[model samples]
Target: MNQPARVLRMSYLVASLAGVGFFVLSVAWLGVWPARRLAEDAKRTGPGHVVALTPSEARGRVIYAREGCAYCHTQQVRFTQADIARFGAPTLAWETRADTPHMMGTRRIGPDLARAGGTRSEDWHLTHLYAPRSVVPASVMPPYRHLFAGGSDAPRQEARDLVAYLETLGRARELAGDEGEARAATVSHTHMEGLTPSPVLNPHPARPRRTGEVPALPANGDRARGEWLYARNCAACHGSTLEGNGPGAGGLTPRPTNLAEHTYTDGRLAQALWNGVSGTAMPAWRDLPLADLGALVEYVRDPRITSQLRHDRTRPAQGELAFGQRVYEANCAQCHGAQGAGDGWAARALAVAPTNFRVQRLWGTAAMRILQTGIEGTMMASWRSRLSGEEMQAVAEYIVQLYRDEQDLRAREGRR
Candidate 1:
C-alpha cells in the first residue's frame, strides 16, 4: 500500500479502537452503577418488610404480574412539574428498594399506580374492574369481569389481593412520618392555574325551595333504618360506613369518593337524591320514595352522621370568591377563558363552548344542573361519573357560595 493510504488506515483503526473502548466503559459503568445504587438503597431500607398483605393480596400480585399490568401501569413516578402537580410527588429511590422484582413498570395506559394505596377505598376498584365505563364513562380500559366466575367468590378473593397490593403503594411517605405536615402543606399552598367561580356563592344564588323538611322518623330516624338501607342498597359498594370501602371499590378508575369528607344542605342534598348525578355509578334514586330519599339525604348530610363516619367538612381556602377564583384558575383556565369567559383554546375544537360563568343564569338556576350534567354536547364530559354524589353536592354548594360572594362584592362596590 502507498504511505498515505497506510496512514489513513492506521488513523481509522485508532479511532475505531477508541470508540470500542468508550462503548465498553459505558456498558460496564451503566450496568454496575444502577445495580450498586439499588443494592445500597435496599440495604438502607431493608427487604421483606411486611406490609400487611392478606392472602388475596399475595394472589393479586401474581395476577398483576401475570396479566402484564406492568405493560400499562408504571409503579414508579417521574420527576416533572406536571406529573407532581397532577399525581402528587415523584417516586423516591429508596421506596422501592425492598421490591424483589422492582415494580417500576413501563407504559401508561392508565394513570400511575405508585400512589394507588388508600388513594381510593376498596369498593370503587371492584366496580371499575367489573365495568370500567360504569365508573369512568370516558375510560378506554377493558373490563376484567371474566377473571371472576360470573360473580362467584373466586374473583372477589383475587380482587382483595390486588387491592392489598395497591394499598401498599404511597405508604412510604406515611411510613417515613412526613405525610401529615408535608401533604397538608402541599394541599394548602398548591395553586390551580385557572378555575371559574362557582354559582353557589352568588349573593342572589338560586335558592330552590325545599320540598319539605325531612320529617322526624317514627323511630327517630333509626340507625337501623340507615344500616338496613346501607346494606341492602349501598353496602355492596360503599362499605358499611359509606366510606367507599365496599367490595366493588377495587376495579374502578378515579375511584369512589369517600363520603365522610362532605357536608351538604338539605336542598342541594335533595336535588342529588331526586335526580342522580348523570353519567356515574350513582344511579338516580327517582324510584325511591321522597321521604326515604329525604331521610337518606339527611343521613348523608348530618354532621353527626358524617363525623361518626369520619367525614371532612373543612371549607376551601376562603370565602367563595377566593376559592372559586382558585378553582376556576386551576381546573377551568385551560378549557375556559382566563377571565371566566367561554373563550378557551379548545373551545373551537369542542362541539360546544364552555359556559361563561360570569352570566347570572349560568351561575344561577342552571349552575348545579350544568355541573351535574358536565360539559354538555362535547368531550368535556360529565364529572358525575368520576365524582361521588356527595362530592358533586359539595362542589355545587361551593359554586353557589362563590356566586353570592361575587354579587356581594359588586353590591359593596356600587354602594361605595
Candidate 2:
C-alpha cells in the first residue's frame, strides 16, 4: 500500500475525480445556490407588485453598474439597528426583484441608496451629479460632469435615464404601503426584534420633508453661529447674498427662494427648518440640532436680511384691497386657501403645496415678477394672461398684508 505507482492507476484517477467533485460542490453551494435563493425571493417578495424597469431605467441601471456606483453607495439595507434607524426598515429581498446582477453591495463608502427614491428632487440630483461639492460642501463624491452638456441644467439623455432609475429605488416597497410594513415585520422578526416602525422610507435630512412637524426654538439664538451654518448649508443653492442665484441654483425648478427678499415669521422658519418646503428643492434641516436651527433662524430673521424687503415694499392703495381680495378669491383661493395657510380644498391633490402667505412675505417687485412669469417647476402659474399688471400688484400687496401679527388685527381690513 505504501509503494508509489509509476504508471497511472485507480488511486490516481480517484483522487483527481474527488478534487473535481469538491470544486463543483463549492460552486453549487456558494454561487448558484444563493442566486437561486434570490430568484425565488424575487418571485415572492412581500411587495407583490414589483415594477419592471422601463427602457430608460434599464439603461440607467447599466450606467450605474458601469460607473461602479456600488463601490461607494450600497443598495442593501441590512438587518442592523444602525441601518434601520436612518433608512427606515431593512431592505426586503423582494424589493429588489428586478435587479439582475443586484447592487446589494457590502461596502458603504457613502450612504445606502436602497431608499433613495423620492428623497431628493430630479434637479437636485442633476446638480449633485454635475458637481457634488456645490450642493453638499463636505461631500467627497467625484463630479459626474460628463453626464451634462454644460451645467447641471443641461443634463444629457444618459443622465436623465440614470436619475429615472434612481427614482425607482424604493418604489415597490412604498407602493406596497401598509402591507409592506407587515411583510417587513414578518420577515425581519428572525433577524432583529423591536424594530422601529417608520412609514417613511428614509428619515435623513436629505429626504424632502412634507409633514407639518416643527420643533420649538430657543428664545435667543446666536447670529454668528447661524451665519456660519447658513454659509455652509444654504449658500450653495440660496446664494451667498441669499438671492436664490447660487452656483447650484441653475438646475432647481422654481429655483431657490430669495431668502433675503422674503420676510419669514419665526414659526415659518421653524417649519422650514424642521419640515422643509414641500414640492420644491428645499430639503429639511432636521438633522441639525435645535441650537443650530435656532441660530439659523436668528440669521435668517436678522434685520439686515429683511431691510431690503421692508424698504422696497410698496403696498397697494386702500381702494385696491377689495379688488385684490376678489382677485385672490377668484384665482388663488382654490389652491392657496382662503386664509392663505396652504390648506386649500384642492391643496392635497397638488404635487406642491400652495405658498403660505401668512408666514412668508415677499418683496413687492419680486412678488409681481413671480406673478408675471409664474414659478417654474411649481403649480404657481403666471397671472399675466388672466389679470392686468395693476391687478397682480394689488393681489401681491394683499398677500403681503396677510402676514400680519395677532395684535395687528386692526390692519386686517387695511384700516391702518
Candidate 3:
C-alpha cells in the first residue's frame, strides 16, 4: 500500500471511533442520565410531588394516546400572561414527570387540557365526548359516539377510563393545595418573564361559584343586533325557531330550555349567560360584550312574546278541571304556591325555586313527560305512580290555562 492510502485508512478509523464515542456520551448525558434523575425525583412523596397514577388512570392515559386526543388538545399550559390568566399557573417540570411519552400535544384546536381535572363533572365530559356540539353549539370536535353504549349518559369502560385519565391531569399540583402555591411563589423559577405567580390559582373560571346574586341585563338592546348574535352563538342549542329543538339538544340530560314555551326574566337570562348553569354543560360567556349580552336577551324574549306565545286551546271538561284543581292543591301547591306565583311555603326550603306557573308555559307533551319522568337535577319527582295517566293529562291542561291567563293579563297591562 502507498503512504497516502495508509494515511486515509488511518484517518477513517479515527473518525469512526470519535463518532461512536460521541454517540455513547450523548446517550448517557441526554438520554440515560436525565431519565435516571427523573425516575428518582418522580418517586418523591412531598407536598409538591406528582402523585402516582392509579391503575385505572394509567389505563386511561393509554386510551387517550390511542384515540389521538393529543392531536387536538395540549396538556401543557405555556408560560405566558394569557395562558396563566386563562388556565391557571404555568405547567411545572414535575407536573409531567410521570408521563412516559408526554401528552403535551403539538397543536390546540381545543382548549388546553392541563388543568381540566376538576373543571367539569364526569357526566359533562361524557356528554361532550359523545357529542361535542350537544353542549357547545359551535364546537368543531368530532363525536366519540362509539365510546358510548347507548347514549351520552351510558359510557363503556374505555370511555370511563379515558375520563378518569382526564380527571388526573393537573390534579397532583392542585392537590398540593395552599402549601404548594406558597412553595411555588417562593421558588425563584416560578417568576418568569417578570410575571409574578397569581396568589390564588383558579383552574376553571367557567365553573360556577355558588353565589346567590343574579346578574343584571343591559336595557333597550337593539333587536336586529340581538337576532344576529343569537344565530351565530345560540341557534345550534336553542334552535332557529327558539323551541329548544336545536341540532345538539337531544344528547343533553334535562335538555335545553324550550325557549318558546317559557318566559325568562331579563335577570335570569343575563345570569345564565354570565355564570352558566351549574350541573349542566352550559358555559359562561363572560367574554361577550355588554351590548351583545343585551342583544341576546332581547332576541330570546322577542320570539317568545310576539310569535310563539302559547295560548292553551284545550278547555278540559268541568269534571277534568275540578279533578286537576284538586290534585294541584293536594300535591303541587306546597311548592308551586296556591296562585302559582312560585312563592309556596316550600319555595324557601328548595335549592332551585319552583317555576311560577303564571309566568311559565309548558307544551302538553312536555308537561306529560315531566309528570312521568320528573325534572332530573331538580326538586320535582315522578308523580306517575301517584297520578293516573288521565289525572296527569288534566293537571297539565290546567297548568297551561293558568299560563294563558297570565299572558292575557300581561298583554292588557302593556296596553294600558
TM-score of each: 0.42, 0.86, 0.69
How well is each residue in 100-202 modelled by candidate 3, as lDDT tens digits? 8999997999989998886766666887898887667678999898889988778899899999999998788889887666655544352465765554465
Taking every candidate in turn, the Cα RMSD to the unseen true structure, in Å, is: 20.7, 4.4, 7.0
Off by over 4 Å in 1: 1-24, 37-55, 152-154, 179-416
User: Judged by TM-score relative to the true structure, which candidate is superior, 1 or 2?
Assistant: 2
Residue-by-residue lDDT tens digits, candidate 1, 1-416: 89999989799889999999999888878987778865664444432353554576667777788777778888875655545544655555566765667767878988788777644444455666666655455578877776666752345667667767877776654565543324323322323224221211111111112232333322224454555555666555556566666665544323333555444444445554554333334444544555566557556654254454342334554554564555555656667667655566766565334544343222232444556665423455576666566555554545443322354466799999
Q: What is the lDDT of residue 259 in candidate 3?
A: 78
Model 2, stretches more than 4 Å misplaced? 1-45, 193-200, 303-306, 312-317, 406-416
Which residue window of length 10 is worst by lDDT in model 1?
A: 199-208
In the range 1-416, model 2's lDDT, one tens digit per residue, is 44466434577788888999999999999989988876765555465466788999999999999888899999988777777777877787777665789998878889999988888888889999999988888899899988899889999999999999999888888888876676566556566666555556667675666776676898469999999999999999888888888888988996998887787777888888888777777888878999999999989876485564556555567889888998999989999899988888988888778888988888647888889999898888888999998789789888888885542454565774
Give the 10-residue window scoring lowest on summed lDDT in candidate 2: 404-413
Report, for every candidate in turn, its global Cα lDDT versus the true structure: 0.54, 0.82, 0.75
Error of 3 at 49 (Å): 6.4
Question: Who is ahead in TM-score, 1 or 3?
Answer: 3
Which portions of model 3 miss their true places by more than 4 Å?
1-52, 133-137, 149-154, 188-190, 196-200, 203-205, 212-216, 305-309, 312-369, 377-379, 387-416
Candidate 3's TM-score reads: 0.69
